[model samples]
Target: MRDLYEVLQIGREASAEEIKKAYRKLARRFHPDVNPHDPEAERKFREIQEAYAVLSDDDKRSQYDRFGTVDEGESAARQAHARWAGGRSRVNVSFGGFGGFPDLGDLFGDLFRGGGPVSQAPETPAEAAVELDFVDAMRGTAVVVALRREVECEACRGSGHTSEKVCGRCRGSGRLIHTDRVRVRIPAGVADGDRVRAAVRTTPGGEVAVAVKVRPHPFFERRGDDIHTTVPISFAEAYLGAEIEVGTIWGPVRAKIPPGTQSGQRFRLRGKGVRSVRTGIPGDHFYAVQIAVPRVVTPGGRDLVRRVGELYGVDPRSGLPLGLT
Candidate 1:
């Protein structure tokens, strides 16, 4: 059985980030979530998790570095991390104290090995959020934005130090070395709240540009070459015949209603929807009419009904069995 160190291919001396990074990479590659029925992947995932558990803890790391057993794979990786203790110290010694002081070499060795330190903090990327409405998304829009980022220090040029105040650890190389890039494009006809990713890219100085969040719009919804809207028409306009105006992205347009039009009748306003950002040909807008009914009838309304009733008397239910009886 391979131990955790072997699974991640790292030594006990690995830092927290190193340990976590290696573990995650292996876990994702072998995770059952991505690999459905592969026995090898499942076993590998378990081994990596166990290794991460031990190496991720500092106490376990110290113990493993000393009494570690020989696993063909883990043994090699552990040695590479400098967890073992066998290196020659460059210290010079003399039989007795020199003319006025101890040998400078021995003093330097003690001070350098026991006290001198070297390491640096890597620069992380900047992040932000952007918003796009449905109309903006469907038509495609460019936006300019401002961001407060961790830029290089003008004095030290981000080396984190100056001749007078430079960081002894980094020697003024303001950034660590790593490079990655990501890019994203917004597609046409994307609905509100849809996401467009921006690819990460590395600068000459090694900085990460993360994706900004894109916001959603409330007013518009997009479909290919079609826009939809609800139109309300009064019952009188629908039943007695009249002209009704429909709202579109461009403007309001009149859609004629023939006599005795029914509720839920759809009216199509061609060439009034979203215009193509490329070709510029406009799409169509479809209006679905809902008839609005009045709440109460007046006495004059009763007279109108009576007169209309006189026009078509006998039996209003002519097709029913009651009419036949």
Candidate 2:
């Protein structure tokens, strides 16, 4: 048999949550209903089931890890039968008749006495991608997503059989494919590549995982929780100081540009950035000041510019390094 960790495609030190996650992913891909009549998929699905059964239980996993097998004394057939029975009930097989052979009818009857074999397939979460506007990503919004997921068959109540017969509705798989339009609420300050989980009504504890893709804003950029933007200001505003309206994720707010502010100088507006989704605390917004030069088309305007230029006591580029060290 393949290593259980290899069967689940996880590392040896994988946690219980990781084991469950890997099982759900592989089970969904190789489920009998998903790949009908495919012998390879069926074999792999059974392998995944076996791997999960042992590793999911802490005691069994510890035993397997220490001894390299669960219950080394038991024969393979008995171990397999025990696993299939799930320790719910026990049957005594008597080889009293027919040349000392066990009665097939009695064994089969006891195995399928209740509702046939329990489905080992895990409930897989549905996945969908949602694209959000930049502003919506910052402020949060609800979106309707189309998803397809597997839900238990109501006819058999998740058992493959009903009244000692296979359920026709689910073809004995005990599950049905369902497509639904679900509304998912994305929390504030969700970043690109983040996944948001939403509950599904049909399946208890089932979730729809939506992958977020935030559209790029033309002027604003996000770094962590902080928002960065370049705000253009008149040259006079930078030199003489002025209060201007600045745009933020929340809205426009008044910000002051200090006197003698140079181009590319950054200013911060405290608590004006995107709110942290996990902490609920707003971040600071940082905007770089870009000096916008006005065109001097008139002779009077040129004269005014020259008069302003004369106000500079030293050359702006005097301190700049002109040679490589």
Candidate 3:
């Protein structure tokens, strides 16, 4: 695996904006259209796109930085930490009682059937990102995504050979561009920027990994599994409690506004929010009350307001620092 930072010529401390700028600059320079005759430049352009894909996403970038690879998800982080700790805290091994550990060379030979290291074939699985709507993410849904990936050529059986001459289909390259359709399922309660990996099955090839991306909701904001939203209420509704319908991911639910409810007061609807990915328990939905005052009033409304003000006879601005000359 290539170091993403090295590929982009960026430091680890590079900001997101800086990474994007570098990617754009290099992409344009190495784009196939610009370097029409250079096949190597086209390959480099693909590599750049792959690097930016990993570095541009926050979650993926964190995973890559900590584990040096994003393919294993959280397990990569744990494995990296274990390796680091093993290096820092070395322990003496007691192999005397366990028939003495086999030699490293022999163990690798047994594993690989030879003295050489085991190498991954070009049919290694691929990863592609798929974006989904917020509502679709809230409720689990399946989508078929079209993926452009490299697959071993069938003409030469991935050898790029046909009786000594290069395979015309792949042009001496063992791989060919293939379009794959894979169904990826987005689990319930998946937040924006969260990734879900689904395997893509192919004939004579390794499985492909699909990464799911949930789009941001317009009105609803998610905190863990809980949903937060603001509900606008009129002055009358805030002063005098009323039952109003509130929109939820599940649907509309009626909520009672308590008398004397003030602006910014939050109300929670239990079991009405997103479901937990691990526990499958639904979280509560919290709605903040936003009291909206009337910008313009009718003659009758103005008269009623004036009468109410006269009856109250209390100065709302009494605590203010401003002075009336």
Candidate 4:
């Protein structure tokens, strides 16, 4: 009977990860299906399995390592030695004198003698997501995100075989680790809040993703393809005909006001709004005229206003039909 560590072929202080790694490697090689009818291979495989069953279970390992048995004065080692060396390999071993293991002869008779192979489970793949700044999303920028992914083993092309394995630099795992920078293009005239979807740049399993963010612009208020903003005008500018320089989403442009223009007047700058990414067509910008009225009135100004009022007549609302619902 060998020490459990020797049977598992790991250092006594080996971490669980190390233990698992060793176990996987050994199991792959010694699995009954792979080995067929080699008696030594069968025995070694059973020993590996038994060792893992104990060590992988913390409580069992702790008890076996500490008191040599769980909750008792006697040791499992003593009974186990007696059962094996005593030529009574079918004897039962108890835990805290509670439950007993049926003899290896009856319980795992075929297993120890040589049993059929066990099935292997398939593995699951991984996916990743990423975010970007406004400008990046609009103009498209390349970013590095730490992706946790498992590629097929290059050695076995994920088959786990050495000679037949693909380059593990890729992993027998089919996909190769990307070491080069990739290019991601962003379209022009993209708004502050929008998404840029891209396919897998150059990798297996086309990765679908969105670059979420906005791009920057100094003078643009986007509304569909139209932009909206206010333009200021002096009282005289609104009352008399004038062509004033107005600021639009694209830049400063000239806008004309008709005679007797009032405040809150709307003017459109055609083909000057946000450009459509799909259509590549420019939209329109609407200008709202704000009249700058004098907060304080001078004597001359008052006289002039009075004269205009007399000329225009006092009953400005005379023609209204107010009560009509």
State TM-scores per candidate: 0.40, 0.54, 0.54, 0.42
lDDT of each: 0.52, 0.71, 0.67, 0.53
Q: Comparing candidate 1 with candidate 4, which one achieves the higher lDDT? A: 4
lDDT of 1 at 145: 34
The superposed Cα distance between candidate 2 and the true structure at residue 105, in angstroms, equals: 52
Write the residue-wise lDDT of candidate 1 on 1-325 in tens digits.
Answer: 4555667998755789888778655654454433335687666765665566567766766666666643333453344223211221221221221222112222222122223342243333333235566555665665443333344446566667877777555557674433222333544533232222232343322322222222433433334345667777886687678887777766779888877776787778888876643235667888777888566988998798678667555785687785555
Model 3 bad stretches (over 4 Å): 1-125, 146-149, 158-166, 201-209, 310-325
lDDT by residue for model 2 (1-325), tens: 6788999999989999899778765654455433445688777877776788788888888888898887742344345445645532332322111112112222222222233453344454566788899889987899999876788999999997899999999989999988789998988787654566676665443666666777878987775466789999998899999999999887899988999999999999899877766456777889999998876468888888899999989998898999996
The parts of candidate 2 lying over 4 Å away from their true place are 1-124, 150-177, 201-205
Q: Give the C-alpha miss distance for residue 104 in model 3, angstroms.
A: 37
TM-score between model 3 and native: 0.54
- The Cα error of candidate 3 at residue 236, in Å, is 1.4
lDDT of 4: 0.53
In model 4, which regions exceed 4 Å deviation?
A: 1-183, 202-208, 215-219, 296-325
Candidate 1: segments with Cα more than 4 A from true spot: 1-129, 133-142, 147-151, 164-221, 302-325
- lDDT comparing candidate 3 with the true structure: 0.67
